[model samples]
Target chain A: MNNDILVTQEIGSFRKPQYLSSVFRKTSGPELSRLKEKATLETLELFNRAGLDNIGVAGEMYRWEMYEHVAASLEGIEFFGPVRSFDNRYYRKGSVVSEIKRKNSFHDDELTFIMNNAARKIKLPITGPYTMADWSFNEHYKDKRELALAFADILNEEIRHLYGIWSKSKSEVFEVQIDEPAATTHPSEMDLVVESVNRSIEGIHGCEFSIHVCYSTDYRMLFEKGSELKLHGYNLEFANRDTNELGTGSEHRKAFAELKDYWDIDNTKFIGIGVTDVHVDYIEPIQLIEDRIRYAIDAIQDPAMIRVNPDCGLRTRSRDVGYAKLKNMVDAVKQIRKEY
Target chain B: MVKIRSIEYGLYPRSEHVRLSISKWERNALDHKSLGKLMDAEKKEILKLFNKSGINFYTDPLINWQDILRMVASLSLDTPFEKISRYRETNTFYRQPLVESYPRLGEIREEESTPDSHLPGSMYVSDNSDHYMYFLPGIESFVSMSFLSPELNRERVMDSFLEIYLDLIKKHGMKRILLFEPYPDSHFYEGNWDIFGSAQVFYVRYGLTEGSFSERKDSGPFSLIASNEKEFDVAARHSEVPGIALMNSQNTYLENPEKLRKSATKMSSSLKLDEIFVTHTEYFDFLPHVIANKKVEILGKVGD
Candidate 1:
């Protein structure tokens, strides 16, 4: 019951658009090719150092999520996932649009297959319908709202198919993570995105659905309807902020208690708060991690549904930095549990 | 008079050169490539006359190389580039060790000795990485989706040229030195830099010594690093931050006949150098200064 959900990036280089371009080389030649190879191997090293065997190919070219695929490439360590190659942008031959349309195209499905094949717990993530619309330039739809809803439909289709894949893969994938990092930027789509998510999961399934909203400095508004228009849990960041300063969450801590006060905030609709920060490359001390954990526990007063994790996905950190933070996080939680 | 003038030398990514970009990037760029090349072709063209010109102690050209020559040299072997003194790592190449030795195709590799003494001090070359081979089947692309395979042995590949590059710098004549060291892109990759292929810095035995271009014999070509400036800076700052700066500016930029005649006027000025270096033209301009302050070396590029 005292378990907490956390959110962090692997390294921020993958998944995020702005960071990807930096990894490119000028000579677009063999030198560039060599650099790409270097980046991949380096990422694996980072993962191993963090004590995490799983790596999600965040969806460029390497199938880092599948154990067998990356086993040899990674020198025999398992922990990997696929990047759902769906897109709201240009429908070029090999673009996101085509990848998403493929059968069992969602990351959830791929991750499920991986989990089943490797006999491991799976982490299924997707760019929420609304977030995808907000970050991408939509051409197929008529208006902004329409485009978001249309994306919602596409996502709904993927969710249904993902359930099917889980069954076929023989893996019980209950964690359905809808990554809505753009939740703050387009709060307008909040309703549409939430609705589409609800609609998608309506009849198709019985899985623990979670929404990952991050990279935003503010989430005060999303706190109001913590219970309404919801799925399973909301994995939000309370650490990796705009600035590198630690021990703070955004500019105002005023809304800190808002989510805790929400009605029906329980084990079903969990609130995954970041206990450690991944930005600035500074790991959280055990005391700080404990404080964050305590804050969530006291505010919510419901340990059963509290999910504590790093400020966000540590996709951006080197292996040492990320793992140390997570290890501290897990340790702090255990400390809290002992006291409880 | 065979006067010996002082030369100042500081490695790139050093503390002194750290803030240089913040200040120097604003200076108006001269059309040195065109007019100077024309001047080299035996034409007369005076340029950038109004601004006060001190000898260039550093050049910020890219290390855009195909191989790991410069990274292996300055960071691993302690060998400086020939003519120009900047670092880069993409689309770069190396000339033969000496006038007779054949040039290497990719990165420089060290064979059986210390490096600084072996390589040439200067040479004119171009970025020559082949893209087709990079795009070959089985190569990785994309972050989460694009997959690639490591094509070559980073160590052996670098050493192949190290042997010859060091020998060349030690023996042959050099005009401008070129280095191919890459700055981390994920941190600052807008406009000025256009790199993305290898995003993370190579690290090794000790810890996170990534991001910096350091020369260490114990590690060979291995770097102790992560993938950003802060980490890299820490590593570089810790790597004995080479002192004893020396700049030997003899025939760097002022070798032309007319430029030589023109520089003769400034010769009467004082060249009080605790440490100073210049191209050949700078030597002419500061003749009197060199006589007064006394530290002038009419050495060829890189003293090779």
Candidate 2:
């Protein structure tokens, strides 16, 4: 495995282990909590074993399942049965039925757990505010803006709490990746999205801030208009569309081609290029990943301004598939390092 | 007189009957035609069950539009549509509203607003006679203007919908349009009051707006879907205006029907709501068994 890449991280979430899932269903309160922590440590150990540069303790924290995680934590939000969409089931719009109160802070205990157990720096993913508001049914707040801002305020408190924990531990936090998968859908609300994001990260310092959009998004709108947003990096899905573009002779690497648009954004310190497509089962060849990385670096016209990651989290994939994908990604990065 | 009408928010069902079909479709085992037929049947069943809930107004099942994304997608966005925009509702579920270069108001076809029916479809609901049909040309500004340039005014986004209503009013004598403005907190306006002012024009002197509530001086009574005590307090504070309370019956409120009943009971006692709208009729599917022997009756039937 290549250790040449500065950071090889799972976006967030790994598939819940089968034994743990069974134990969770069978066990009660404290026993279930104990199993969850065990599973989290095991999950992180698996990633570290996979030789990952960054690890996140995602067990039972709802890693990057933005709305569900927030709904599980916050007061006033109520979740119903799966609302059947085209093919998949989503938790019905979590209605804000009461005044939103903090039931518990997010990631503080999880980060503490990670710091004590893991050798690598932790990359904690907090679901961004826009996603929480956009996905839920706002029965409480007056508008989407208020709903999002309320989520932003809650998230800010959680982030601050997390930062305090991290500071006290004095452990390395690779970066805080704010997952805003909903940002690009409603372009008109980009202003609010930007404002809400700024609110979520307001005043917290020392930790790097990265925004991860798990789909092909309106980067031009987000980066161009959201220039005021405090950010250190932008992670987006490229391999989901450009998997076919991996062919050496392929003329148009359409996903990477859009990188030219974001080349001029001043506030964006780096682009965490998604080189693995998490949606599929096929293990992407190291050569293909190397090609994708090379194309992003070439297209963006900077080698230092690039990091490599999967198109999204691998929680959906089986553990075997997820591990294979990460191992391949790291190997590809190593090959690139050798070539360069 | 002010009337309280129940409005349904459409999130499709996954009953045991449709579960296999859904799974098959997800696995690509079932084609679009089969899945469409299965989903259409499921929606009909859902609506029928909803009708039995004894609410003031019945909203026909509207499950086909896969969230707002699929709802907006039926329209023909201008050519050279760039697919850069995406909204991921879940890990797997998402909608990418393609950027329409030349968005024309005329591009919105009639079938875009209609419920799922294979009968060479028309614009209006199949049976608007029984209940106040929730009609719309397209989703409001936040979504309709999503793909359009961000600089455009929210009013401009409402223009096409306004024209559709104008035509409906002229042709069908469409009296009351149920305005479904979902996002009132977007700072698109200051509060629910502000959203009501801009949107009231579309349904002015004629229809009902449920999602975002406000007091109307020129039109019908003020109405709102207050799910909790605070929202009820806000609606009650504005008690000077005659209005109806449309309580959200979905979510955790539905799990414990007793809680919902208690809230509704207390709310009605505190404020004289002209009418109470217990929303999301599908959740009430279990109501028959639950309320079978119970004397606590929070819902009553209404005949229009």
Candidate 3:
């Protein structure tokens, strides 16, 4: 392993194998567990082949959808019919009818399985409190901020439980990435996001915390108020809005210009820069991915402060395309590592 | 006694059948004409529900529209939208428009706007001589969803679109227009209310909190949409306007029809208003077709 290279990690989710996804909801008990394990094992092998420094829960196979997964395991939420997120993909949204309490440990099985089987380092991605509050219909709590704080308390407990399980075997810091796709949508609620996110990771030591916010129109607020968040890094999407041109110039890499804004606010936190777009099947050339990373490295001027990944989850793409995208991203990092 | 009226505006969700057809059409399994037929059927079914509910005005279900902003952007001649962004705070997404210059309006075909023409237009026609209501994104909302160039004049761009929309309303015989403005606190439309002159315009503001109610003055006749009773109370206390929309269209959980009717009656009686419109606070597009259908029935019952 090249220690000098920037850490390359899978952000949140990957396309599950047909054998697992086809029967994910239909079967339960040992049958579903067997299939999820099989799929996770396969995905771990694929990540290993892609030369990933960190595999995110081996493609998050143990859970179905992020919102539905957490909401289903909670006491107060009631599942309504499915609604479209984008394209044809739909997830069953829930309404918080009462005070939310954890009905079950959300990521225990996945994390336990990864610890036993995986060789590389692992990062567990949990849906953040702000996103949980934003996505659900709020029928409870005094307001969205209060509901978010309630969720933050629940998440703080869940993370502590997961950390207990991970600490038994591992001496190194356990990684936790809070997935908050709705983080920057409401610019006025940045304070709520900061407060709730800080509360989620409150007093949870020995765990490196990060936030994954994908496809936002404006990330300035997140960066501006980022110093207040108790997170170690931010994973954000850029390639979806960026040009594919292979250049490090200001005009060539228009989307990466936000790195300057981020650097202006705080330069200490790492950025898991998304180099490939997950919404399309077109495989970004290695040079294009290299230009994206090169632009970030030039702006930040630190290899350790930069991480490379896809714009968002690769669940939207087919397995082959996702694997190819990751492979190219890793290869780009490798080519750039030789310079250091 | 205060006169009670019911109406609905904003995009209604597509049924499973229509949603499936669209998915298939995207994959090349179904043809465009076939998909159009499916959507047309969906629109007709929604229209039937509206007529049976005895709504005083008819609005397009907009089942085929991707979102409010995207539909509005489609009317632009420059193809301003480039990237998909989240629609406000909702899980649904739309292409964010980037307006570099003053946007010129594309030609509006008579078939596209006239009540006697195609699917959405046809949706506006009723058996009786009922008024037609059209839903549009307000000026602030349009600016919020887009990236305006530094050189572009905001008021000029807003005025241009507003003028075209007014012309369309007059030409197509649309009696009412509801501008969907979710964020009133932004104050993006502070000095631009006069352009709506003489048009029966109602600004629809949803996702409001108690703090937001007192933040802005009532520029014109507008309606406040509340998702719950507490919000309804807040709106009641703040609104000196004639009408209010009080229901949550963003969720799938069915509201208690009896409770909703009672609440509407009590609010109307207490407020001593001349008119009350019982409808969803936001776009019904956030819901499933079956649930939205049920809510429409409840809306009719409340108004009755």
lDDT of 3 by residue, A237-317 (tens): 999989777788989999999999999988778999989999778899999999999999898888889988899889988
Residues forming the 10-long window of minimal summed lDDT in candidate 1 chain B: B131-140
iRMSD for every model: 25.4, 8.4, 5.5
Q: CA RMSD for every model? A: 22.4, 10.6, 5.5
DockQ of the candidate models in sequence: 0.01, 0.10, 0.29
- Predicted structure with the largest DockQ when compared to the true one: 3
Give DockQ: model 1.
0.01
Highest TM-score: give the candidate number: 3
Is candidate 1 or 3 superior in TM-score? 3
True contacts kept of each: 0.00, 0.16, 0.45
Report the Cα lDDT for residue A170, model 2: 75
Quote the positional error of residue B118 for candidate 2 in Å: 17
| Residue-by-residue lDDT tens digits, candidate 1, A1-340 | 3232332223222322222335442345666545545554454444444433224332221222221121222111112111111100011111122122223353442354344333323446655666655543232345557656655766677677666666774544456667666666555555766666666566656677787765443465566545565577777766643222234352323334445544333344777776556544667677766666665666677776666655555644555666677667666766777765
TM-score of each: 0.41, 0.61, 0.82
Pairs of residues clashing in candidate 2: A143-B184, A143-B185, A144-B185, A144-B186, A145-B185, A145-B186, B176-B207
lDDT score at residue B270, model 1, on the 0-100 scale: 29
lDDT of 2 by residue, A72-140 (tens): 788898754444332343344566777787789766666777778877767788889998887675667
| lDDT at residue A272 of model 1 (Cα atoms) | 72
